[model samples]
Target chain A: MVPAPSPTPMGRPSPPVPARAGIGLRHPHVQRLLDERPKVAWLEAHSENYLAAGGPRIVALDAIRRDYPISFHSVGLSLGSAEGVDPAHLARLAMLYRRIEPTQISDHLSWSVSGGVYLNDLLPLPYTSEALDIVCRNVARTQDVLGRTILVENPSAYLSYAASHIPEAEFLAAVAQRTGCGILLDINNVYVSTHNLDGDALRYMRSLNPESVGEMHLAGHAVQHIANHQVLIDDHGSAVAAEVWHLYEQALEIIGPRPTLIEWDTRVPPLPTLLAEASRAEARLSEFRQTRIHCYAE
Target chain B: MLSDLQAALRTGLLGRDDAEARAAVANGDGLAPDARIEIYRNNVFQSLVGVLAAAYPTVANVLGEAAFRTVAAAFIKSRPPRQPQLSAYGGELPEFLAALGATRHPYLPDLARLEWARNECYFAADAAPLDLGLLGAVPPERTPLLRLSLHPAVRLLGSRHDLVAIWRERLGGGGRAQDAGGEGDHYILISRTGLEVQMTELSAGAFTLALGLKLGLTLGRAAHAATLSEPAFALEASLARLLSHSTFTSFVLSDPAEEVRS
Candidate 1:
């Protein structure tokens, strides 16, 4: 039998990840993160990356978590799966969350499993009462086991569900309200899905209840030309496009301030590149706050 | 609606039937349902394929990129991933290799196993070395009676063929050339010492003794098993190696009921 995990470190949880620009702590940058401890306000790590019971990487993360607030982002939760959440995966995640004591924990709003098979990739889910019910229960159960409310991230999508009753923002808002969880708003996903499906990205952004949003994500994507039709790919490899940055600025305008993470998962560039992207996000947040102060004074 | 809704979502992802597929697709312009589904299908295939490719780079090299992907897709489809972690995704590849009718190379399965072990050791837990001082304080009479504790990262593998040589050829300093004349049964001890994982060949007796110790055998019993396997085995030297390698993180007397466990 697995031993009960070490308890969450007692104390005030590290101050919530600042509502400033942070970076996703991917492996390529682990050493760099330790060595430089760049000026980024906080860092978020993929939960599965540190699932090992022990290792040098785990040790490094343990050390880094001491200095930087961490947000444990999960890709494998399969929150929208018809099958119940994978208990082993949940247990492992719970164990890691306990050990890390991250300021915030999050997973995607997508399903990765079907017919007893895991796709190992985030799959799209329909927006219906049934889908919403499955997602809400899973979210609540996940939060219960982890002993904390988690932020469910909206996924980048290429397809839509015909039987869906609610709009995407409403679906997410409903999940947040029903489950008492929060949202990790991935602005790139909204932009990508919006561009791919030809919808108003700003409208989707405006519809989300800002107070319920726990965090925000900013990432870069690629434009894939498929058979003369262009699809925006959430590749997270290249530089954040100007339009997404603009959308992020718009989100900052509406949402006020929340923890923002600059994600660069694939085609990861040098550490400086990620930090630069994060710095850009920080500047935007600073500008947004300054503008709010000016408008209020006026 | 909860479980059934989840089931419907799954059916749509698997792309099993068009009616379910149609229901899953978004009717919004610019993105057709088939196209959206295709995007997801590609993402799923690409991600899992990347996991397999990482786990079996040599296999991928041997089969070439396209062929490896073809085989990986089939293996994945036939044997769906049970574990959410991608590191745990390819445990069945060795068995799959054994049954894959089109493999030009017969030894690929063993190599895949070696790579899998490498990954396992890479991600296994860290452990401190057993305290030599504590073991030294043990009364000489009970020293041999003490049970040795292996690190959680320890793995002992005994293969029927010279898969060890094959692994070394692909990965070792000797370079990548198969030695048909070097074929023989082989044993191995794989462990992690920091971030890097390494594999070392072991004698049959040493391997058996280490395996026994790993299973929580007392030092005396494990040594006895080692001697039974090979009369000329050196227990002291092996213990010293394990101690130096930091493989034995802790030790205890075989009898847990006893108040004095040291």
Candidate 2:
């Protein structure tokens, strides 16, 4: 019974997010962003953060959106939910996108809702065709509602399922082919999931078609020893780890270059620290742009 | 099959035990399925609890970290967010506190209620304030039948505890707590402007009138209810004060169909 969202603010869409590094538009740095207005290429916001009906935060986002191109990195779409995506959540997202006219939008490859309960973490899915159908159905429905295709990111999974038969990248590539969505290709998540599941990270990347990639995410992860076994948690609380940074460089070499975002969600450091991390990503992206880069073959 | 697996996984993550969820998972390289499922359980709890902590910081402060975590863990396990928006996740916490016999502080539930109200008001829908000048032009006879629509971000909170003083003290404004033993019921009006949430204590009669209007009663009936609740309720002064606070959003014109609406 939800009403239709208004048409996209601009009859024609604004320019897409630039192929350069962008920093996360977090709450703590909102004031500094308004006052200082740094020269970052673009800004990415967690869509759920600005979903309020009316508030100063919403006002701030409106003002900031005027200054920079934005991409909404949504976590609540829950594309992998077994019961299907929540209609209300999808409708709300559609409204927000129409209002903001974000350059691009995306959600994780995992599920967070089951039996009407919303689990906060992005839990992994068994890479089977049945699950693939559910994901495609959800993604298609979302795209139909938004009137645009969205990219799906690889999630940092803590567990491996024996029922999972299809390889991770192959599963993603299949999703892209079936749903017309693109891959987000988080290098840190690639490292974290592969490390936790004892899979080959490079081999996983090799299965994905480089052309299917539309954007990239790089974030810091925490290494922890649980029950005498080491697992890398994609906490997004600190700087992009050295291993993740190296993985990001290799991804740039493979994927060519895309709108890369540096996400530091947890112990969010100062603005300069985040901007510095973004500058590192910017430097690498600039290097890729300067060269005769060929995407990695599947 | 995916639904059954996800259902079992839900039980695994939020249930008291993960036996069913562990059975659903495939065992690991150098790790058992139990340990793998346990990892997700830990992640789910950590993130969900973090959401609750942010929503109910004053409650956490009053209860201290360890006790608050215990209540939060129990509350979230039983009541995982119904919606994907974690911002709206912790609404049932005050009721949950009362149900748990979490009587560490007598005013804890009311304080938690006030906090939830503030949270809701902060993020509620935005609407422009009703123009008093326009309303004044209405004929006096027509005014009695006019129904007022309350602002989206306005909330009327009634408690036995002096929540404003307590909230201020806990927020480190250095306000002294008032003795509430014989103070009767407390009515608080909460509305937000910009990032600041303004809290003003209201009289019993004014609260009654505001509550009636919020519940869709016409102005005359709402005022009548207010005066009946408190025989000394002053309508003129209370109306002026509520108007100054921008409590009402607009006046809903009567529809013939909803005319019979109770």
Candidate 3:
């Protein structure tokens, strides 16, 4: 068995992000984050947004990084692509990682590119032996290059492939077991996929290895109609759905308190609105923490 | 087999070869496989259209949303982004616009070019400005041998139409397209200073000199080129202006041996 690679040493020792709620950092909220310095536990930035050589966004992130521990959530890695990972993209990410030294880093368990054409959407993969082998290889290679174990988020799939024989939870668990990477369990994604595919969200959550879950994502999804059927779209445009929040509470109960993030990308509300959402998650986290403390005392 | 599946999916998402690809997807939940794939198809086009709209705001403003979406969809079909970075996706859009034959609006291509340059300038690499003292330290006699380097954020755009006027009007929230006046050649200089990317209209001679310098010409050669283009070109004044704008990042004394070999 190949030994897991050690975590890459950042230039300076980064402050670990607390197991509390945070908000996904957006461009419009940069000023508020800097000026007001909100009381969120941390900020999570899309790794691809800061890949540019220079920009106000990069500068803003630099200032914001000083005040809060950051997590780099990437969408462009295409970890499940059959072509494997692109070396150029990896190098660009490495450059940004070396500069920012984010506390946590992650990408999705979906493919976005094939045959050199990047679709820019998290397309689902067939959960067969072929795909599992490819994903495990890609995850291992990415960890080896980044010199750190990255958290792989489960994709909010729109469709299922006919060739998929393995369950999604088992595939993710197997990937983590092989690559020594953690899972960035997206609760909203599970809710969305289950609603669309007529599956059991709670069973899927229960199937995951709780120790392998390092972070959790809670985002707003839109509901759309198709042939008089309701399908949830992971648009991240509005407030977190009540059903998703209920599922999130259940997840906290099962997975324990993790670094949860409130992701509102499209039609993003004012800073206070996102903060309110983060506050809701933080309330639940605090409740769980208090319960655990009381139990230990007893 | 994975490659074939991806190929089929790509074609299907673009609304081509739907039947074969739809068969690969499991159908259930009262939604046809084709309808399910259509969601991704619409999303792929709409999201990419949004990217182009954001990058080329003036173009989208000039063409209006519906027409802009039409043109963007065509462009995406013809030239999808190969890289994952969307910011660097639309480099060929100006050429695409030219090929689209917007003969009525002749300046559309140039306006798009300007917008593309601004898009690039916004994300160009950062570099420290060269110390003016270094240029001052060079002996007057050896100044002619000095080669100046422009910042990565610097871009020069020469257009036959008055693109700056059209871009300015659209950027200022002018909903209606006004007449851009008579056609005349324009020289524009784009550079990022501090945090803001600034666009300035430059004289023909200044543009010539900047272009020459960007091509690795020595100060003396670039000045000669500038004067050749415009007899009244003031080399000292233009150099002062360029330096004040922080256009150049560094300078070096050209190696005589390398110069001779070239």
Q: What's the TM-score of each model vs. the native?
A: 0.90, 0.92, 0.96
Docking class of 3: medium
Model 2 per-residue lDDT tens digits across residues B1-262: 8898888898878866677678767775566788777778888888888888888877777777798888898998888898878778889999998887747478888888999999999888877888998788877766767788898889999988878887877766342344243357889999875466789888899999999999888887899999998999998788878887888878955553464664
Give the per-residue lDDT of model 2 (tens digit) for A85-169. 8999988888788788888888999998899998887888999989999999999999898888788999998776768899888
Worst 10 residues of 3 chain A by lDDT: A1-10
* Model 3, span A176-291: residue lDDT tens: 99888899999999999988878899899888889999999999999999889888999999999999999999999888889899999999899999999999999999998999
Candidate with maximal lDDT: 3
Ranking by lDDT: 3, 2, 1
Model 2 Cα shift for residue A62 (angstroms): 1.8
lDDT of 2: 0.84
- After the best TM-score superposition of candidate 1, give how far the Cα of residue A276 lies from its true spot, in angstroms: 0.8
Spell out the clash pairs found in candidate 3.
none
Q: Point to the candidate with the largest TM-score.
A: 3
Runs of candidate 1 with Cα error greater than 4 angstroms are A1-12, B1-19, B27-31, B160-175, B178-181, B255-262
* lDDT of each residue in A128-202, candidate 1, tens digit only: 888888899899889788877888888887777666777878899999889888898999999998887666888
- Model 2: TM-score, first chain: 0.94
Instruction: Supply DockQ values for each candidate.
Output: 0.54, 0.68, 0.77
lDDT of 3 by residue, B1-262 (tens): 7777888888887656777779999986567888889888888898899899989998988888899999899888888889888989888999999997855678888889999999999999888877999889998987777899998988999998778778878887675455454467789898888988888888889999899999999988898999998899998889888877778999999877776776
